[model samples]
Target: MNDEKISVDNRDYVGALASGLEVLSAFDVQHKKMTLSEVAQITGMDRAKARRLLLTLHALGYIAKDGREFRLTPKVLRLGYAFNASNDHLDVVQHYLQSVTSELGESCSLSILDNDEIIYLVRSSAAHRLMSINITPGTRLPAAYTSMGRVLLAQLSAAEQKDWLARAQLLEHTDNSIVDKNRFVNMLKDVKQQGFCVVDQELELGLRSIAVPVFDYQGKLLGAANISTNSLRVSMQSLIDKYLPALQDAAKSITAHAK
Candidate 1:
């Protein structure tokens, strides 16, 4: 994730709290357990500052120290649980996503745009795996490359889209990834008009996915709902003709049910 600060100039911003949260976020799937030095290196903080924050978190029961390495404790789950409990609509989303997964026998996911990435909030997986990594809630993917990302991006206003396009780094993740800025902008326009997006083997070699914007009862965009499958297993045409309707139906259901 990008380490760029969003509102440092705000008078109410607490630098210490933000730094502590950043330190906590540095521990992910790749860096589950890390020494003080490792944490300092990943967060770009000096060893002394990292040590103080780690000790504070350890005292607060968020981190556990084993020998020389520190790892997150199960208590960290309370943070996630608090988010889930606060959002009453997530249960509805999960139910409909699971329904879609069962109907189509493919992985379904809901994600919202966070900075230049899409963070998964809910997922329903099929029997088959689509990617090498395990994609669960909290998984982050590049917004410029994924179908759900494009769908969310399409919902942005023209000026906001232009600002995003200016800062986004268009990298080729695979042979099929779109790198041309003009073509990408045109594609976003089409996604905005069509109300859906389909990405074919862009993020990974064999992954194909389709996505549609999901909203609440007030027409507030909740996120993007997606169905992902192996390219060999699902054709592009089938995704539009079959999966698209299923996803659109789920989105409508979410809007009707979600507060």
Candidate 2:
């Protein structure tokens, strides 16, 4: 479910807890460690509020303070571990994704839409790297510019899609990136009709990927599974004629075993 849909005025909505979690999330790969002022700036909270949250997290063993900077501790991993432990289907996804990677000789990933971004849930990397940055689990990328992201986004209802487009910042990442909202919406319609998507050098130059939505046995939408490769090494036709079938088979296997 989209937690962002929840109203802040609701009785169950704990603003302090939400703010604290937002502060924790603010420390990512780029901002690994931050001072109170830095955290406040990143999270848009006042320095005093940020300091209180940081200290509270430090007291709870989730954040560690070294001199003046605060960084996430190993205890923070427990939150991710709890998610992984509860989802038994992840192992099945990993196994099938690895098989696809071994057979196709390309990186395979499973990603779910979160807000306007797609979060990588599982990844099986081949020898070659498609992107300049490493894409591990928890890596997030713009949903509008990725094959897996498009596949997942296409599954959303019309109102949800409209809401997403209204709030999304459609920036041109590459020359091929679609910045026109109408063009993007039309592309999504095609993706939904075709039951898959192919993003060609949109997010980054020389990065091409094709994705299909994954579903459970009961037809619940799980996420999108994709095979990513360097555009220089793989052509768009090859993605459809070769990698597409293999990816579809893996998605079927995942759905069959997810029960």
Alpha carbon lDDT of each predicted model: 0.95, 0.94
Encode model 1's per-residue lDDT on 117-202: one tens digit a residue.
99999999999888988999988889999999999999999898999999999999999999998999999999999999999999
Estimated TM-score for each candidate: 0.94, 0.97
- Estimate candidate 2's RMSD in Å: 1.7
Model 1 has an lDDT value of 0.95
Number of backbone-clashing residue pairs for each candidate, in the order shown: 0, 0
Q: Compose the digit string of candidate 2's lDDT tens values, residues 159-249.
A: 9899999999999999999999999999999999999999999999999999999999999999999999998899889999999999999
- Summed over model 2, clashes come to 0
